[model samples]
Target: MLRGLTTVSHFSDDVPAAVAWYAELLGIEPYFQREVQGKLAYVEFRLGDYQHELGILDRRFAPPGAGTPGGTMTYWAVDDVEATYQRLLDLGGTAQQSPTEHGPGFVTASVIDPFGNQLGVMFNQHYLDVFTGRPA
Candidate 1:
């Protein structure tokens, strides 16, 4: 049995810049930020829709090899894929894949954050309707 994702943590060389970038893109200010072991380090933001807390951690304090971005990327469902992609680009995010239709009514795009983590934005009205048993 699975519950739900609680948090997604990312490592960054510059914590302040990473936090600011994410805050601007996600439109959510950090709910918590604190120093750990006498060093100003971790920052976490609670995103809209209660998805999960996004964390920006100082890579110097991260465990061995933990600073590297994993093979798997994280995706956030958005109502407007194009608008969000543009916003990300404007906020210094690098576009890895331009918005594309994945299937009937499903669109997706990928962008790399300042710290090299891949973030994806997806829109799928058809899939949503099917999942919720409603007309699209």
Candidate 2:
């Protein structure tokens, strides 16, 4: 059976630049990196309460049909969707979706990073409840 997410990977034509961009956005440098054929091939950062892995891979190793920047979007939990969306924009991410409310307790936003990956942020009551051990 499928389990929780362990790593989220994004591809970039320039791995070093992507790593630098993400480092600035996250306010931390990658904890690990790998090189292939004397060229930087990948870098990874551990983040979030559970230390989820965010990886940037050199596009040269991507699969044949994986040239496109995005497909399915994965939303990360945030305390404030609007603030996070604004921060992403300030970090040079292009706006894809402005903060929008869904139902009573869910707000979501998305952006396209300079590397062309879709990064989503959400303020969800359920996530906050679980994270804070509070009843919803």
Residue 60: error of model 1 in Å?
2.3
Off by over 4 Å in 2: 67-70, 134-136
| Top-scoring candidate (TM-score) | 2
Model 1 score (lDDT): 0.80
Model 1: residue 23 alpha-carbon error in angstroms = 1.7
Report how far off residue 19 is in candidate 2 (Å): 0.8
lDDT of all predictions, in order shown? 0.80, 0.89
> What is the clash tally of candidate 1?
0
Q: In order, what is each prediction's RMSD in angstroms?
A: 3.4, 2.5
TM-scores of the candidates are 0.81, 0.91
Q: On residues 14-45, what C-alpha lDDT tens digit does candidate 2 reach at each position? A: 99999999998889999999999999999999
**How would you encode candidate 1's per-residue C-alpha lDDT over 1-136 as one tens digit per residue?**
7797777788888888898888887777899898877765999988745447888888887778774555776677788899999998888888899999978778999888878777888897864665578444
Which candidate leads in lDDT? 2
Model 2 C-alpha RMSD to native = 2.5
